[model samples]
Target: MTAADAASLVPAAAAGRPGTEFRHGLVVGKFYPPHAGHHALIAAAAARCAVVTVVVAPARRESIPLELRLDWLREAHGVTPWVRFVGVYDDHPVDYDDPAVWDLHCAVFRAALGGARVDAVFSSEAYGDELARRFDAVAVCVDPERRTVPVSGTAVRADPAGHWTHLHAAVRAWFVRRVVVVGAESTGTTTMAAALAARLGTVWVPEYGRELTARKLARLRLDRPDATVFDVTWDRDDFVEVVREQQAAEDRAARSSGPLLVCDTDARATAVWEERYLGSASAEVRAAARRPALYLLTDHVGVPFDDDGLRDGRHLRAWMTVRFRAELAGSGVPVVELTGPHERRLAEAVAACEDLLAVGWGLADPLLPVEG
Candidate 1:
């Protein structure tokens, strides 16, 4: 490609356009987690040269896996003929302060390419210049100030949900895991969920059934003016619709939720509710209970039950607690039964959530303890 053709590939850099006259180019990074910025840098390189090779070199002990990161690049640019993705899985020095870091990475890069002619190096970091010089190619910097995409992996990791707009869909799936809190009424499910989300600095999915029921009651009151509440009298259709809507709300929230989704109630709990009041539950509602999630079963505290005119008295509340245990029995789902005062329950719930993220989601140190 000529210099002018290569220049067109540079995406409005503040330093004007760097020379991209070359037959082949290479873009290199640890790409700890490929963000939109990484995609732009690689695309810029591909547009400037006849062919471009992108390398993902991950060091030891990263929170995310090397293969997963490599897959992100491939999924993003695998269709293009000019764009090639390669991965370097080694324990090489990641810090530039290490004297041999450059040479070590250079050897790995050349080995991965198998002596292919590289006429240019594309990157958004200052080290791009040295990497290019090592390969006898010119360095074309694309967004040193992060003006194009304007995000770093560190920021994304710190608050994935806050930066949801910048993450690739594939990466979002890895970060999204659900932690549903389910129990009988007045067991502090909603209270614990709110506290956990606040402590973790993430979003929470509220119980849609409560809102739906409130609306239904309002509609009923318009006709039967004497009707003040509706509980065990709810029909099978009511329970089924609640279960479906609960799942829908959860699905929508998970798309934008951060590394962890704190759910006040889930489809499984909805089924338990269905079986409790309706005398019979639908197969579809039971099927929805099969989703894999970290379940936190809240035990009833000795606190007074605040009957919101919707609860079926204290007797049924106690019965429903037993029903929850029976329904979850032999289900093979991971369970953490929480019992104690609200403050102690919140602490236990937070630890359970952190453990769930670390073990189930493969996140190393997923949640940092919140300070007062």
Candidate 2:
């Protein structure tokens, strides 16, 4: 925890500056979940150094994987030509109190840089002093009291929703759990989805297909002044577009949303709509039925269907409800049927989501779908 002379750790003279010049700098951390605080330290280092190498070190038992941490770092600084990001691992203690730990980290740090001379080490912790001493470099501490960023990875991980603003979009995506609300018309799925999201203090994704349909209907009405609700038609291409846009919107929301993302209707719901409108669904639509999601299936209790040019009457609604139940029954994903009044329905949906989250919820490391 001992720091080098603060006077000796003055700003480096680079290009146009006139203090000390750091040809190469180093910033190393577990970056378990990179927060704004980490970014501030890197910025401080990058300001005085010609080049800064960030080494991401994750312990074997860490919940967040090493590769994900590397991804976040790369995403945060990929465009910065002078900032190089790397990952290192060793069987050494993670504690900085032990001299062996410092030695092990120094070796790993040197290896990550391929023996490049590090003139400075930047960090917010006192350990930066020892780390810099190992490299014969100056220790530059940025926001040692956490006043500037006022957040940490540990705090973010402990309560993602509470400190969600501190997390990067890429890191936020790692914790977002997708909750899809599906049902026949007039079942209050949309209301429940939005309310649930509000209750959970997260984001809610509106039904993409509904918006697309409304737009198409408006255009149709303009084309033919006599266009009626029955005039609306959706071909395979239209449904395909809906599916694509729905998934895309969900993916985008996942990147920046809090711990939970409530969906009014997901890709799977779009697929069901396709099957309801068309004679059969496409392979892509069918595939969506198999994707992992926490589904809230709304029960049809003959709630009066308010026609918005999309309603197909009670018979069709009842038929679609049966189809939705049947599809959900064999989909192998977790499903909870939501019945009763609006408050009761939302309560059940919230309870179901909490239950799902308790059991590890969606796929582990959902942000890294390709790697998984």
Q: Which number leads on TM-score? A: 2
Tens-digit lDDT string for candidate 2 (298-362): 98884677776666655777787888888778777889998888888888988987776665422
- Clashing residue pairs, backbone N/CA/C < 3 A, model 2: 12-20, 13-20
User: For candidate 1, what is the TM-score?
Assistant: 0.61
N/CA/C clash count, model 2: 2
lDDT of each: 0.74, 0.75
TM-score for each model: 0.61, 0.82
Candidate 2, which ten residues in sequence have the lowest lDDT sum?
A: 1-10
Off-target runs (Cα >4 Å) in candidate 1 are: 1-33, 43-170, 231-233, 290-293, 358-360, 363-372
Query: Model 1 residue 216 lDDT?
Result: 71
> Candidate 1 vs. truth: CA RMSD?
8.9
The per-candidate count of clashes, in order, stands at: 0, 2
